[model samples]
Target: MAAAVEDFAPREIVSSRGARITVRAVRPEDEDGFHAAFLRLSSESRYTRFMSVVRDLSEATLHHATHPDATREFALVAVAGDQIVAGGRFVAVPETSDCEFAVTVVDDWQGHGLGRALLTALRDAAAVRGYGRMEGYVLSTNLAMRKLGARLGFSDGPMPGDATTRLLVVVLRGDDGRAAGG
Candidate 1:
């Protein structure tokens, strides 16, 4: 029997600001777009999304991230004009009941609503997959993500990383969109 999750087709979504534009989900043929979008992110933006300084990516990470799948590991891609501007993921981790999330929008797209849209898309996807919770870790310095978390109903908490360096973005009850603390 087909898993219920397979029935969900992530529809393409687009968000535009003035002459700028964005679209959701990368195509299998858009590897270069994926690579370029990733490279456009500032180091800090990358750190906030990946939770550390991403020295670089190995081939495996790139392939798995771009391949469209019905499983818990899914991605939402965003584009602006000729630029592949941003992306995020709703990832399934088998060891926990909760799914995890990460988003990266290039510097230019930061202040706009892209992050929130990507996050909302990821959160809704999690709910569809029967996940009642999601958790994320953001560097303490990345205030935008921290604030976005609060707006999206994520509870704030300290991360186990260096005392002043990391903070955890947690949404305790993923279903209700309530503020959940560490």
Candidate 2:
């Protein structure tokens, strides 16, 4: 089932540099803006996020990104006026209460705390959907992301079969207690 657009609430926050940005769910109508944001990413940023050198997003990738399956996937975008400055998402792991997530912020917007905000929103949304944990693979050289993961309470370890990346996982909390994997 697809998650209704209204399922995610929009939030307004002031960045570290004092710019007000809105964070909300990614909608089908955001394809153009999303693509534009991808274009604005620096080559290194793209490589860090995708774990490879990706100069452009393919048609199918764009479609899947903007049209998330509500039951097993969730995505959000941070907008500064008409521009998408950052985005994040989580896809559920089959037969498990965990989801793998990814996040990216535009080069100009880096260090403004937008990435952290987007990630927090993603975590909250996933918990609401009953996901007990969220994880992601970060390039070993991306120290900023590793720090952010630590700040967000995620534990990290070497990714099996990949020396260039590390796996970070955060156990979500539920009403009863810590989520399943915790």
Candidate 3:
């Protein structure tokens, strides 16, 4: 069997709300918030984001997504009013330094800039760690996400065979004024 990679948990730094949410590193303490965030996800939003129904997300599943090791993964959560309303992750491809990313914001929080913040945070974090680029496959129906990606420097193409999806990639140069990492 292959050696297991370390799991990553986001460290809460702070929220734009001025409320303290640590983005420093993820810990076991985040399990509950992680679960609740997924549970609270509306079915439609879940489908939109995950490209699946997301009928149920067990604790193990949540842990797998939220708690990857910092070396291969970087994740962040957005919290306000004692709940994690948003979060994101970037998974480093083993064979290369590039990464793939996804961001989520609870339905009520949609259009509230939380998604943008989460993406910016993850992109900067990836760049700092020496990732030269990042990309994602988003459903074509998710014009909002596509638009957000475009605003953040993503370009689009057909997701080969799955016409409903669009693939996009962007380079993340360190010191690039484009990222919110500073």
The positional error of residue 99 in candidate 2, measured at the CA in angstroms, is 0.3
lDDT of 2 by residue, 104-150 (tens): 99999999999899888887777767777789999999998999999
Question: Could you tell me how far off, in angstroms, the CA of residue 107 lies in candidate 1 after the best superposition?
Answer: 1.0
Note the Cα lDDT for every prediction shown.
Answer: 0.68, 0.88, 0.73
Winner on lDDT between 1 and 3 is 3
Clashing pairs in 2: none
Clashes of each: 0, 0, 18
Name the weakest run of 10 consecutive residues (lDDT summed) in model 1. Answer: 1-10
Q: Root-mean-square deviation of each candidate, in angstroms?
A: 4.4, 2.5, 5.1
Ranked by TM-score from best down, the candidates are: 2, 3, 1
Q: Candidate 1's residue-wise lDDT over 1-182, tens digit each?
A: 01133344544454445434554665676677778777877787777677668967777777877775555576777766666777887666676657778888888877778888888877776765666577776677778888888898787787664655444444444345443332
Model 2, runs deviating above 4 Å:
1-5, 173-182
Instruction: Please tell me which model should have the higher lDDT, number 2 or number 3.
Output: 2
TM-score of each predicted structure versus truth: 0.77, 0.92, 0.81
Q: Higher TM-score: candidate 1 or 3?
A: 3
Error of 3 at 66 (Å): 3.4
Best by lDDT: 2
